[model samples]
Target: MSDLRATFERDGFLVIPDFASSEACEELRDAALRLVEETDLESLGSTFDAGGQRHGHDPWFLGSGGEVRAFLEPERDGDRLRVNKLGHALHDRVPLFDRFSRDPRLAALVAELGLAAPLLLQSMVIFKHPRVGGAVPAHQDATYLSTDPSTVLGLWFALEDATVDNGCLELLPGGHRLGLRSRYRRDGDRTWTDTLSDEPWPSDGWRAIEARTGTLVAFHGLLPHRSRANRSSRPRCAYTLHVIDGEAEYEDDNWLQRPPTMPLRGFV
Candidate 1:
C-alpha cells in the first residue's frame, strides 16, 4: 500500500494492481450483466449517452434523477442496489461501513484514511458501455459527495480490464490541492457534469491511468478527473465505494421514494 499511498498523496489518485482478483471481478460483472439483460422496465426512462445519442447509456444501468432508477430488472430490484451494496454483499452481508467488516483491504483502506467511526456514504457502479459516445467532462467528485474533502475516498474497482483505448480514467496531478471547484451542467449529459477546475490544469500533463481486471484505483474525493468514451467493442464496468469521516446523510430527498434496500445509516 506504500506505493498507492504515495501516488494518491502526490497525484491525488493511485491504481493498485490486481487488488480484488479477476474471479471476484468476473463474478460481479456476470451479476451486473445478468441484471441488465433481465431488466424489464414498466416505465423505462430514456437512457442517453453523455453525447445525447440514443441507446448511448446502453448495456448499462445509469441511475440518475429523483426516485426513478435509470433501469429496472425484470424480476428483482437488485439492479437498483448501489455500488456500496455490491462491496458489502460481496463480503457476505458486511455493511462495508463497519470497522470490523470482514474485508481486510477495505478495513486497511478505511484505516489509512484515519477515519474515526466513518460512514459508508454512497456506492454506485459506473458502467461505461462500448460505443457509448462523449466524455465524462473533467470534474471533482466532491460536487456530488457533499463531504469534507479529506474524509472521503472514491474507490473505483474495475470489473473488466480498463485501458486507454477503451476510455480508461484520466487525472490531473495534484489537482486535489485546489479543493472543490464549481460544477456546471454539460450541454448534453444530464446524469453528470463538468467542473471548472478542468481549465486550470496543463492539458498535456493529464495522464490516463489504466489498470487490469481486478485493479483498484483509490482517489481523493475532490480529485479532478474524467474518462473518455469506450470506443472499443467492450464495456468498462466499475464499482465506486465512498467512505466519509462521520455519519453521512442522504442530502437528496428522492432516494426516500425508491424501492427500499439496505438503510444508509449516518446523519439523518
Candidate 2:
C-alpha cells in the first residue's frame, strides 16, 4: 500500500475505512464480553496500580474464559504479567494478521523503510472502557518497542465507533520524522511515560479521526498520539497489530516472547 506509506509519512498515520466488516466487529465484541462475564475478577492475576486500585487481572489468563481482555488492557509498568495472554491464539489464527504478514504491499513498505522481513511479531486486540480514560501519555511507540526508527508499523483496527466524544485518537502529523526521544515516567494515572520533547510540535496537520466500526488506522510507531477520556456511553475499543520487519530482532519484552504450553504444529 503506497497509499499507506504516503499517509504514514505525511500524517504519521493512515486510517483505512471499512478495513473490517461490521460482522467481524460484532463477533469479536461478543467474544470479549462473554470472556468478561465468565471471568472472576479476584481469581485473576493481581497487578497493583499507583493509586492502589489493583487493576491487574488480565481477561486472557482466567481459565477458558480466556485472557484476551487483560492482554488488551495491559497492566502499567512493573506489573508481573510477562507474556501477552492472547498472543498464542492470535499468532495461530486471525486472517487479518496473516494477510498483512504475507502481503507484498506491506512487505515492500517494510523493506522501503529498511526493516527486516516477516514484517510483524505481536498481534492482539485493545479495548478502552467507557469512562475509563487511563494514561496513554504522549510518547513514541519506539520508546516501548525499542526498534529502529521508521522500521516498525503499528496498526490499530477499530471494532466499534471511535470518536473524539469517546476518546478517539489524536495525533501529531509528521512527528515520526523526528528521531527517538528519551523515555519518561507517566504522571498521574497514565499508564505509559516518556521523555517529553523540549520544543514539542503540535499537529501542523492535526486530525481527530472519528471512524465507524471496522476502520483500520496504521501509523509509524514514533508518532506522538493520544486519546481523550471516554466520556461517551460506549467503550472505545480497537485491535492493535504490531508489525516489524521480519528480519528485525524482537527488541521489546511482551507476551509474544512467552513460552507456549503447547505448539500448534507440535514442533515444541
Candidate 3:
C-alpha cells in the first residue's frame, strides 16, 4: 500500500489489475444494458457529443447532475438508438450501482490515497459503442468538478477489455503537476469554460493504458487524459466515479450541481 501510494503521488495515476472479479464486471455490464433497454428512446432527443464545440451548455446535460439520465450518441442507425452514456446519479438511484460505488474496497482505496473525508460526487457508465463511439477531448476532471483546493479523484473501472483499438484511456504521466488548465462552470442558465492556464499538455509522454476486464485505474484531478474514437466492432464499456475531499470547499459555479434535496455521500 505504501508503494502504491508513492507511485500514485509521483505519477498522478495508478492502474490496478483485477481490482474486481470478472463476475462483478459482468454484473455491472448487464445492469447497464438493462437500464438502456428500459429507457424510452423516442422521448429522448438530446444527442451528446463530448467533443462538440458547444459542449456542456445544454439544459438537459446541465440538469443531469442530480438525476439518472441517458445521453445518446450523435449517430443513429435508422430507428435504432445508440446510447453514449448513463450518468450522474446512478450511484444513488440504481441498486447495483449504489452497492458497487459504496463497496468497502473502494472506501479503503480512497483512504489509502490520503483523502480523510471523501465525498462521492458523480458516477457514470460510458458505453463506447462500436463504430460510433466519439472521441473525448483531453481535459482534467477538476475542470468539471472543481473544489477550492482541488481534491478530486477519478476512479475508472473497465467492465470489458479496454484495448488500444477500442478507445482505451491515454494519459500523460505526472501531468497533474502542470496544474489546472481550465474550469467548466455554470453561470445562471449558461455554461462556459474559463481558461486558468495556457500551458500546453505534452504530446510525447502520453501513454495508452490498455486495461483488462475489472481493472481499476485511479487518477488525480489535474491529470491530463483523453480517449480516441472507437473504430472497431467491439464496444469499450467502462464505469466511472469522481470523488472530492469533503474538507475542501466545492465550487458553487461548477457545472455539475446537485439540488438541496440530494446531498453528496461518502462510501460507508
Each model's number of backbone clashes? 3, 21, 0
lDDT of 2: 0.55
Of 1 and 3, the candidate ranking higher by TM-score: 3
Reference-based lDDT, residue 67, model 2: 18
> Comparing candidate 2 with candidate 3, which one achieves the higher TM-score?
3
Residue lDDT tens for model 1, 194-246? 45544464576777988888888888877878888666777787766666665
Residues 180-204, model 2: lDDT tens digits? 6754222222324345456665647
Residue pairs whose backbone atoms clash in candidate 3: none
Q: Alpha-carbon error at 168 in model 1, in Å?
A: 0.4
Q: Tell me the lDDT of model 2 at 30.
A: 69
Per-model TM-score, in order, reads 0.69, 0.68, 0.96
Best by TM-score: 3
How well is each residue in 82-146 modelled by candidate 3, as lDDT tens digits? 88899888998898999999999999988999898999999999999988888888999998899
Q: Which stretches of candidate 3 lie over 4 Å from their true place?
A: 53-55, 77-79
Clashes of 1: 3
